[model samples]
Target chain A: MSALITCSHVDFGYENHDAVVDLSMEVEEGDYFCVVGVNGSGKSTLVKGLLGLLKPTAGTITVAEELKRTGIGYLPQQTRSQRDFPATVCEVVLSGALSRRGSRPFYSSAEKRMATSAMEKLGIQSLQNHCYRELSGGQQQRVLIARALCAARKMLILDEPITGLDPWAIQDFYGLIRHLNREEGVAIFMVTHDVANVVSQADKILHLQQKALFYGTPSEYEKSPQGRKFLGGGDLWE
Target chain B: MGVIMEMLSYPFLVRAFVGGILISICAALLGVSLVLKRYSMIGDGLSHVSFGALSVAVAAGWAPLFVSMPVVVLAAFFLLRITENGKVKSDAAIAMISASALATGIVATSLTTGMTTDVSSYMFGSILAMSPRDVKLSAMLSAVVLGLFVFCYNKIFAVTFDESFARAAGVNVSFYNILIAVLTAVTIVLGMRMMGAMLISSLIIFPTLTSMRVFKSFRGVVLSSGIVAAVCFCIGMTASYRFSTPAGASVVLVNLAAFSGFWAAEKGIQRKNKGERRL
Candidate 1:
């Protein structure tokens, strides 16, 4: 399979502050890549770079280029926003598919169908008419995931998707990710603080510390010195 | 009673009523988005800034509408840029603008001799003085805003809900944020004739507060708020005519009543639910 995204010697920052430097990595099609790092280690920065939200100060980046046509899906961390945004679950999900269409015309039924299907796949069809702000954390995450899916992307980038979820919800979320990876062939690049579970679920682990520390399979990561040191010298997940 | 009947039959009154409804519709829709974006205070701040623009426009002997539009629009753009950079919290920035604008407006009015003569009209509106031109201008402004809202609804929804998520999803959040601010400026600029400076914020806020208590969906909140605002505008217009009350104050009072009534009803429902669960 063709590589979906490639980041080469990328340096990124905000004004005078440097977040990430000399980072190079490639995400292959159908890869479930988990990026684990301590807080403020530029994990979110890497995700932003991958999504083209941040332009690198140096080096080159290449993405699938389908983003203009099929669009890229993104699920961000749970944000505590106003509870009355005046949108339904369906409307929110419909926004995901909006990237593929022009803003001048109304949404077609096909777009609505696509949004509905995406919500159904995430088991959030019952929330179609409900207010987005009223949903629980887990439900909101699912709705957001569904929204992302509506964009018809070959890849999904999630920033700390399971951070605020319950244990059960986290497990279910992982299961959904696995399903999306295996069935839809959508490449997954997730930034997570869940160090323990990353080893079992992620096909590859990219550890960041102002740079790319590790980029390899989970087994390779386990044998690496930095992974062993960071993973506490043993299998923390086990 | 005779004046009320005569006012109703007059073409200008019809224009005021229609213009009021149109303006309220746009305000109600934009209010939900503004509240959701957590920048409701921007409404108050920007309207105050428009007061400065109004004073300056009057002083320059230009049509206040034309002068205020460009000024307020520029101010809104400046505010959006400042807040979007994350250099300052939105509330703090709005407060800064509000204070400076209010002070400037007071000074500008003092400098302009005729400004003080009818200063009270600008504060609470002189709906009775509205001409057909004001009504047509308001209608056009309302239509443009509503059109923009519909055109950008999807991206706006994404940005309003989770801006970072929208950004990651390839939505230009800054552009959309600016769009929202500009829309808000337009609403404020048009609403000056109906709500005036002192009460404009109420027109943007009360409907959202009232409907948020009763509606669960975002769309529901927007639609319900629009309905509430339209109803209030109609009722207030009628009351103003019958009771010889101030139009702006009457509409604001009606909206406040609706907001408080909804607040009470929601509390009653919550209590009833708790009682049932305890039983």
Candidate 2:
């Protein structure tokens, strides 16, 4: 598969210190690349760099031209404040398309159609007018996923999306994301702690703790010494 | 009825209504974004800054509008900056600026000596204080706020909901955040003549919060906030005129009443939903 994302020796950080140092990885087309790491491992920061939210102090991140503008829909880590934000699902989902809507202050008909389609795709059409905060965790995640989808058709970057979900919801969410990756053929770059499900479905795995510990196909990762140590002897107990 | 008509015919009352409505609309415009971003306290802090500048202007025999406007706007921007980048947290920054400005205002007022009535009037906001020139200035600033807000509605919505996501989507989050702060500063300054430094922030807070009891969409909140603000101000102005009550306090009370009613009604609805689900 061809590479859609090419990060060459990237170093990213905040003002005082670097969180990610000399990390290089590639997200191949239709790749379910799961980034597994411990807390404070710079996984979210790396996602920020790739999304162009944080500028790399050194090295390069090249996204394909077609997927550059509104091409990589991002579902950022849902925080406590955002969970209670006073906005409807429609408004929240519609905002994902703002980057591509250009100078128009009002949402265009086509953009509205895109939002509707995204909501339908996630089976959240009925919840369009509902307050986002009032929804269940699973439902809220679906709305967020629809929002990300509205922005980009080619790829999704989900950052710790299942942080607040219950077991049943997590399973449902995993099924949906896997379905999106396999059936819709959308490349997914996920930063997750769910080692079992992500590793099992992932085409590639990049184990990180400030730097790359392992980078290979899931099967290859299963045999690696570092992966065995990290993944508890490569047993997918969950 | 004849007395009410006579009051309406007075030019100062007309000016009050004109300027009050304009300021109310503009405040509502900034209200949703401000309250949502958890920067509602910034409005109160900036209003205190305006009071300090106003007292300085009064003591120095300067134009209050000219003296207070730039200072308050600068304070607003500074507050935004320090809150975002500096070591001090936003609430603490607001508290420091608020206390310091209030202290400065009280000291300046004490030095002025003879203008206690004017200073007191500013503190409580006399409806008669809104001159024709004040009306014109507020009208012009209101247009600018309305124009910019309408032109950048989508971008502002994105920034309000998620700054990181907005930044990732290439929305210039910093610029928009600063823009919201600046507009809020302008609203606080303009509304202070009718709403007072002590009470003007209610205009910046009440409408959006009251609307949130019912509407979930950002657009819904904006529209409803404007309507609620305009209606409450009208009622407050009319009641204050008829009863000779303090206009600023009257308007704030009106807003408080609306919020109380909405809150109760929301509880009722939730209770009803629970009942239905139980059945």
TM-score of each candidate structure, all chains considered together: 0.89, 0.94
Overall local distance difference test of candidate 2: 0.87
Interface root-mean-square deviation of model 1 in angstroms is: 2.1
DockQ metric for all predictions: 0.55, 0.72
Model 1 lDDT tens row, B150-268: 77766766778888877766678788777778878888888876678888888888898899887776667767888999999988888887888989999999998899898998899
Q: Write the per-residue lDDT of candidate 1 for residues A100-130, one digit (tens) a residue.
A: 6655446889989999999988889988998
TM-score for candidate 1: 0.89
lDDT of 2 by residue, B54-150 (tens): 8888788898889899999899889887767764477887888998998898788887775477778777888887888878888898888778778
User: Which candidate leads in lDDT?
Assistant: 2
Worst 10 residues of 1 chain A by lDDT: A78-87
Q: After superposition, how far is residue B117 of candidate 1 from its true place, in Å?
A: 5.0
Q: Residue pairs in steric clash, candidate 1?
A: A86-B218, A86-B219, A87-B218, A87-B219
Q: Which residue pairs show backbone clashes in model 2?
A: none
Instruction: Give the number of the best model, judged by TM-score.
Output: 2
